[model samples]
Target: MKRDRDLVARVLAAKRDPRCADDLVRDYLPFIKAETAKFMGRSPQQGRDDELGIAMFAFHEAVLSYDRARGAFLAFASMSMRHRLLDFARRERRHADVISLDERRPDGGEGDERALVETIASERDELDERQMREASRQEIAQFAAELESFGLTFLDVSENCPKQQRTLEACQRVLDCARKNPELLDRLLQTKKLPMAELARGAGVERKTIERHRRYLVAVLLAFTNGFEIIRGHLRRIVPAGGDGR
Candidate 1:
């Protein structure tokens, strides 16, 4: 509820605000870590700590160049962190020569061979993790597609609010209204596959109204999903596993 001053504004105003900057890091570091780990495929032995460190480095880079005029902090951080992790993964692979199936173990003993087999197994596990990450990404892609069909934009309605409190309140109101309206709700769900005009016709509303509602809806969903898990809970009931909000 209390948005520790707008980090972007604070950064621009003073050219620095320790508190605001720290708050921004606190708000986004976990997200950066989670997303980066998902993209990089965490190793059971290596753990996520290395990836977390890389993400933090990426976050710091983002903070230096963050432009409020461009986009939300989360969107910027997600893209920045994703690129950082990918680059890090590339560098790591370049440094370490991945062993082949027919390669001999350095120690040349039965015990060494077993250890090598374990290492190869770990590599395979990494591939499996990559597959899972790819699947989740595809799902998110589908989720975005479903949302677009409804003719709503991921527009920033909150940009108009100078104050964070107002922005949060606006998000709440949008969520509340949409949740209470079955026609709008149905349209939102079906939008996963249908076109915006089609969704508007189904909802019996003008295309502009649907567009407006979309910006508001995204704000609330982002807010709820960020801290409360409320949106995910609603999605669970509304969308089945491997199914969009149909």
Candidate 2:
């Protein structure tokens, strides 16, 4: 069952604060690229790949349009991305309503070519769908294990997640502080603990806020610091607004 409340909360939060949506986009860039790469059968260059652009557009569409009715956000996003990719592929292949009578079918027979083409496409879609499902499962499992290293779980993150948009952005600022100073993260990895004072001081967030949301920050910072490509893709860039050092 879809978590309607969570979906609604996200929608409301995003509507009130564009940062929420932007953060989501930042965190999911890797996932988007993965979908595009899977379709293209190669890695896409950021600026050069039209397919990647189509995939991104589709992803943004999913972010805005997703609801409990969509089942799951990422799943919906993948489906949307694939559909856009397919549409682009079809458009590119169309040339002046042209068809080749001499074209050989995949099975080496030519009658009902259009029907066979649709059949082939359906099979490919099923295969791609299965592959993407497995990939999503792996990412979740891996992320869960990573959280375990910090003595944390998804429940902890869910319970500790900042409800207010400002609080959420403040947590993002904490992350921004850590990113500027690599050793703070190093300290975290070495000790399996967050450097609270340093993070709060550097990021200019209140130490109490950092402490209160330490569990959530742990998971987030780990994703940003570690090579959690898919997770990193979802994160939006943060520009801290007048962090207080004193």
Candidate 3:
């Protein structure tokens, strides 16, 4: 179910209210770390507890400057967390002096300093509009190819089921599953709309298998949607306003 507008409004209000800082932190911490993880390649601690600490700080910063009327809360939070993590990565690369390695432990040796230097140097070279252009192209091409592949898979599934009864049965199952799970349904709908065969292949199941489990898959997607809604709402309310909003 969608959250009550009033409740979301109250939560948003609380984030800005000095008294609700702790409450807001408790509510949105998981969301902050999750969003940050999506954008980060890998951290030294990997999935250690410290990631949560970094995410909490990022979320707090986001909350300090969020503007409620512009968009949904969690979407804003996701954007904020991504920027925060990216900024951290950039800062770590720029100033080697700020970092310290544990000299006591044998396994806690310093990170590859030369690799870090090279990475920074490489970033300095193409960190321009050209990089943005290439990234955009790659994102689009990847999306397109995935859709094409899925479409082919769908066609193959349809072809394989020579029996009309079986094909109709499969379609019915898929429909039923989609109705139960909104997330799975959305992915299926997107697949239908884009006709992507590659995504189907990448999913590591034949299009028919997805079709067969469509209803259950839809249910799982719906669950994710429900959980995300609760977390995302809090996140959007916390985006800090300074610097580039993107």
**Which model scores highest in lDDT?**
2
lDDT tens per residue, model 2, 176-229: 777667667667765789999888888789999999999988887776554444
Instruction: Encode model 3's per-residue lDDT on 1-246: one tens digit a residue.
Output: 156345346556767686686677777656665655545435324357454566677677666655433233454455455445555655655565235422222223565334343344455555534433443443334333433434433344334432455544443344333333334434543343311243344333358655544433332222222223332233334322212222
lDDT of each: 0.49, 0.70, 0.45
TM-score of 2: 0.51
TM-score of model 1 relative to the true fold?
A: 0.40
Model 3 residue 182 distance off true place after TM-score fit, in angstroms: 30
Top-TM-score structure, candidate number? 2
Clashing pairs in 1: 146-192
- Per-residue alpha-carbon lDDT of model 1 for 1-246, expressed as tens digits? 024235445545433765666666676666766776666566322244677777776776677765432234454556566666666765675455354445656556656654454466567568647754664464356345434544444444434332455443443444444434434443433333213464454435555544544555453343322221223555444222221221
Query: Alpha carbon lDDT of residue 196, candidate 3?
Result: 27
- Arrange candidates by lDDT, descending: 2, 1, 3
How big is the positional error of residue 131 in model 3, measured in Å on the Cα after superposition? Answer: 10
